[model samples]
Target: MSSILTNTSAMVALQTLKGINASLSSTQNEISTGKSVATAKDNSAVWAISKVMEADVNGFKAISNSLSLGESTVSVGRQASETVTDLLTDIKGKIVAAQESNVDRDKIQTDINALRDQITSVVGAAQFNGLNLIEGTDDVNVLSSLDRKNDGSVSASHITVSRQDLTSGAGTFGSTGLTAAAYGTVNGATASDFTSDAAGKVAEITFGVASLAANDTYEVSIDGTTLSYTAAGTETAADLASHFVGQINALGLEGISATDEGAGVINLVNTKGYETVAVTLNSTSDANLEITDLNGGGAPTDGDVGTIEQRASTIDFSTTAGVNEGDSFKVTAGGSSFNYIAGRGETMEDVAKGLKTAIDSNQPDGITTRVQQDATTGQWKLAVDDANGDGTSTTFSLAVSAGGTASGGLFGLDNIDVTTNEGAAAALDNIETMIQTSIDAAAQFGSVQGRIETQSTFISNLTDALKTGIGSMVDADMEEASAKLQALQVQQQLGVQSLSIANQAPQSILSLFR
Candidate 1:
């Protein structure tokens, strides 16, 4: 133990000092860099986790930028749509003034043309960074989220916005690959053979024997108009029928006439041309009046319509695939052509329903639609007819064609020449539709912008939360780091003095050897 060669005390002291120096260096690093785990050498697992979270935070920032860009682009489109709507409203006012026969329509026409040109300008200029949502049918995706899984997999999420096309361009069409019979395809002679437009279809409301009742009530509904009759002073069924018939005839409802066909049968004939005349009798009293089913011969069910007034034409749909997303069809009937466009990812059912809506809403006259599916063949059918039409017009025809551009435009509004009376009348309707289109576009863009804004805000908040989490894992605690630095410095100084003392022990051993 006292040998000069083996200085155990000095060696132990030197090792202790070396350990203290290493700790001091680590504490100093934490103070300077302000991070407890800046490198893997400090805390490998924690540093790696913090690095990953930092990467995600950066990714979220990039997503925020994308959302901001998308929001601005959509905002521009919304503003332009609003502008177009205002212009159309102004044009409508001019057309309303032109409706009077004494007004100078030519001057109104000039003003209308100016407004039309302004709408075109707005549509063409509504682009943002080469993206025009109001003129084309395309989708835009904005990056909104970055998801990191437990297994260390990353995936990107986006918000998809659809374009609202308000362009007033020519419509295109395509084949549904099927055909349907038009109204009056069957001979008009037989009532059963005709459709809802069975003009001569006899609608009879018959009565039973003279039943005694005071104030017994019964309601008769003909073509949606109801007539309620109450028997007074114990009147017979015949008297009630006659009284009701006389009351109906006195009112002189258009296209309807009543006559006593037989003993107690009040036969009703709708001479208003090819349309439906429906008659229903319901008893509100205790006595039930029997109603005969005269659908086949003189009267028809709603579907068993003849070539009568209020008839429905059969429109079958045998659609197929291989259709382009923008494919559409135009059906011309009764002076108006209906344009139907297919939407993205829509089935044939959706297309057919859309067509039914278009035809019913914007059709000539009071044409109504009754859509049903052929149960056996599993095919779709649309029945379109002017519910109050007269079959006298042999010029009526239904034709369908393709090769039209599907636009959100008011059909032919750009070509409105309101100088002429006919043109002025047409412009009035067209301008309203144009205004509606612009309003719809504005609404759509507004919805998409709102979604983008929400996503942007969420991403910002999420990014901040992630940064805080990463800081919790790797950020140096300044108070704790300061305490450790002072303690390590004191230990370093003590270790130096101890090493000096141990070396003096080695000197003592050297003296013994001398």
Candidate 2:
């Protein structure tokens, strides 16, 4: 027990001093770096979670930038559309003035034409970086996404913002028949004067045309009312006069006349005057239809004149019958079959285009598409019309396929989708809707962007708080560590001194033994 190797006091004191030195160094590191877990060795769990959150924050920043770009593009388009609307309103005012007979009719007409031309110019020039929303050019997609709920329900933010061009300048009203008809004149005066009764009834005029010039003007009269119009160069007898009457009849105006060859009696329909009247006609060899009884009397009643009313545009869309997302619905029209997967991004446009191309291409079925925007429901519904080549225009509703979600919808806007089964017809309607939808969606995004920005700032601060929390749990207290280190150093020195004295005593015991 008295041997030098058995001096445990000194060994313990040296070990204690080494422990104090390690504590001092640790405290100094924490003080200098201000972080207890700067490395994985400090606290792996907190560091990992914080790193993941940081990555998310970075991703959010990138998304914010993308949203910003999309917002600006949509904003530009909305501004252009609004500006063009103002111009259209101004044109409407000019048209109203042109309706007034007391106004300088010719001057008003000229002004209207000029205003129309100006509107055209405005629509043509309303473009942002070469994208014209008013002139009916390109479409814009606002980048948006939808979120799915745990119950399998899906909701979404409009990721794609599309701008619709409504500038009537595209001149795409195609193939709607609107040509004039051939006229039959019996002859008697300048091509412009027509025979009429005292009540302004159109008199009978029949002419045998031996190849009239393309722009020749013909005037036929009954009593004295002259019915004058231009003739096409190709006008011939094979062409039925009734074919011409059909259109004019639809205009609520008297447009034709006839005579009984056997009775030498003339029957007429009047349009320019208040009451229908009749007059006698005397055929002259002047190559033009001539008439006498000039202004004596006899006008046709309203019953004698036919009326014409324009039917609504025939449009249709294609969709499956009562199918959900898991089910497949196939619509074959215009020679092609468009299939829809329930709950997927099956747009009315996609369905409409198939029918339009099919019908126009004459694929046995005269299929067309019409889409409607129900401003009341805010649902973009797809309706397919007339299953096959049948002349019936029927409508059926379609929704997102099962497992499919809706996105890019306008906030507070109802029925934004084209609801017609006819493609071109749907386009005409949607061209207006797509615009309003985008505007509403953009405004919604603006509100959301503001909210997200606020949340981002809050999240940033929360992250700092979390870091502070983890630091509180494990970080070294520098002031306390420093004080403890000093105390421990003093204790180690005293222990060393005590151990040395004890060793000396043991040596003295050995001297006594000697």
Candidate 3:
């Protein structure tokens, strides 16, 4: 029944060899390319996803570059600010030395001027790639990330750094820019506190009675309010005092308190206002009782009793009696200095009044001035009171120097011509402020630089993560591909031999015919 034309065995072998050859070729392609899905046709959905992630990785690399640039720029500004702070500290030392009466202040002032010029140079050169963060009031942005949302939307993340201005040129003075602290370490205007014991004298109302008798009555009057108390027969002087105390306590007068001292004496305290307090007393039953003004009808002579310390800051003009037409004196107080130059026909009184006027010219808030004259000693004093005090725990000092020069520059911190006492005093305070500003700028820049560095590192790590994800989707398993290549090669060889054997079966049919 087998015919030479229809050799089914050979046909089946040929088809099997063709299938094995095709699989072998595909395995070789995978080994060479190292990718299971090298083209969109291989895995359309996975390939598209990997492509999108690859684009993200590239974008993140660019952001890393931007962050590097931003970090470098901030570093430069931070270093410059630190250098300026150090220079300011050096100038402060020179100013402190000038405070000594024996030192040559003019020479120290020259050193101060040189240091100021160097600061100007440092500020001018503090830049990276022509971007100066400490010279202007603009903001710089650094690309930090590419945010991809779940809804298939994309946005960019940026780190914005603001600028700190360190310029000391035009518009930097006269209250327009770079103003110093107006009120430092001074008393503030406050609620007036009245104290009877503040004058260091005790006010006493006395009674001549050896003991209290029945139906004995005494009256106490304070700040225009009077309360009377009657004693029982068994009551002594102490009991009379206690009964009076109970009555005043019941009244609960505002800003005033009453206490009973022993031996028929009463002590009254005024805790309310700055007004002069008047205390009077009369007794209806004690014909022998006596009351007197302990302080001669005024505040207690010793200011150590329950008194609030008033404007106690005093600038004595006692040492200023050697009057000359051209002599000058300088006093530094309240973060500024007041210089007084003696003119013709000006006395120590005029000098004291002149300094008071100069201090008031600053127009500090809640500040009041008084020029007190000691008529007996002919001594004049300038007192400054801060109504609104600086704070509860604030304190300050004043620097007064005499024999000063008439023509020396003041502290713009550049014009610190310490040839005179006034210039040296002003520079001492101004330099402290300048140094603080520089330190603050350095601290701010350091924070920004740290942020940029952190963001840059995060972007680099995120880019690596994305690359690994893309690899997982598209990379070939080389170990599995190598095994498949050997297996497919063996299958192909066997298929070729089988095909040869099947073709020979067709020739056997021919031999049968022979």
Candidate 4:
């Protein structure tokens, strides 16, 4: 069947070798590249998806950086607030000295002025990268994006760091008055134990004071009662004792009397069975002085006056002469009677703090008020805190106008003062409520910052996951591709070999004729 004209066997062998060579080359290419689909023609859909996911990952990296920046900004604001709190504490000491009569009131006033200036400087300088939350003029907004629905409805998340604007200005003070009020009770147990015998009563309240110079007057409010006395002659242990007993009986109360134990020590006896009543001392002196705690033990020392060993609710105004529009004041507020100050060098935001001090000072134990500012109007308004805690609370208007009134500063409400037309206690309550509002807002920023950080981290992780998924769907498998290419080359070679064999059959007919 073979003919010289056609070498079909050789042709088949040549085709087979070509096929094997092609298979080996394909396999070698797959091994060298390590990918089955190296181009878009291999798998277009998967490649597109992977590209999209990678873009998202890049975006997320940028978002993570933004979150870090936002966190730093908020941290700076928090530090400023903390610093202000410390300055307020130092100011409180100077105010207490104003109550003294013989201690050079002018000098004390000068010291107070200096301290106020220092506070202003601190607040003004407390800044980071041109952002200052305390000295006013700064608004911080942390940017974030959220996908609310599956349809790609995205919403922006914002965290605002309000400025504690302590700047002083005129006509900025808002009226803060209340509808209900309550007074604090001064417990007498700490002063001296009271005793009563057949002689009716003996008062045990002894005030340990530094040298009480001439022309000094002392006022004692016991169990919500007011008793006043003036030092007629030079201050001695005997005269102070006699005055204490006389004032005790003058109240027309039973079972309460006074006794002078020795040297500046006095003991109060409760002839009655009530243990809740106590004596409070308020000094009317022109000298820079201090008031010791009513229950303060031992003889009064040079530094003991106005020494706050324990806290009481009653507010003692260092500037008792009353304040004008510009004068600042300091007082205590809240359940713990946390001390704070208002007036001069204080911004509208800090004024809210003054309001809280006024409220807490009015009552030893009373309802706590919470305050808030209207963003549009900038007014600090008050409401009851934990309305269910004690006695029915009422709404009070601290703002001059309801809507569209320039009431509060960026920090909170400014120039706000509590009024007693509502009630003395209510006035104080309103003040406290305003301060709480500002504090609550500051807290809100902290929460927002935390949420932003969490979201940023989530987005970062989600982007990475998306990239991995996309890669799995589209990335080429080089080993599998190489094997398929080898198989295809073998099929092509076999076809050629079969065609060659068929051609040889025709040649076989020529051989038959021979």
Best of the candidates, TM-score: 1
Relative to the true structure, candidate 2 has a C-alpha RMSD (angstroms) of 19.1
Q: 125 in model 4: Cα distance from truth in Å?
A: 4.0
Tens digits of per-residue lDDT for model 4 on 380-424?
432223212232222222222111112222222222212222223
Ordered from best to worst lDDT, the candidate numbers read 1, 3, 4, 2
What TM-score does candidate 1 reach? 0.69
Judging by TM-score, tell me the better candidate of 1 and 2: 1
lDDT of 3: 0.63
- Candidate 4 accuracy as lDDT: 0.47
Candidate 2 global CA lDDT score: 0.40
Score every model by TM-score.
0.69, 0.40, 0.55, 0.43
lDDT of 3 by residue, 1-514 (tens): 6767888988898999899888887778788988887889889999999999989998898888999999999999999989988888998888899988699776776787798899878888998998987775557888888999999799998998867666653211111121112111222212221112222223455556777777777776766677787777777777776777777778887645557888766665543323335555565566564444343444433221222223335555654345544355444444455655544344666556545545543434444456666668666766655444343213333333334322111114444556655555545545655676678779989998999998888888899899899888988899999999899889988998998988787566666657
Superposed Cα deviation of residue 507, candidate 4 (Å): 9.0
Assess the local accuracy of residue 483 in candidate 1 as a C-alpha lDDT between 0 and 100: 94
Q: Pick the candidate with the highest lDDT.
A: 1
Tens-digit per-residue lDDT, 1-514, candidate 1? 5766888888998999999999889888989999989999899999888988898888998999999999999999999989988988998899899989898888888888898888888889999899997877778888878887889888998888778776666455655432323211222223222333534345556665467477677777777777888777567777777877887788788878788765566777765533556676766564344433343454434321122233444455554443345557444444466666654543545444545545544545554455556668766655555444444223333343334445444445656666766556556655655677679779988998999999899999999999999999988999998999899899999999999998888666556557
| C-alpha lDDT of all candidate models, in order | 0.68, 0.40, 0.63, 0.47
lDDT of candidate 3 at residue 389, scale 0 to 100: 39
Task: Please identify model 3 stretches exceeding 4 Å from their true place.
Answer: 1-11, 172-419
User: Per-residue lDDT for 5 in model 1?
Assistant: 80
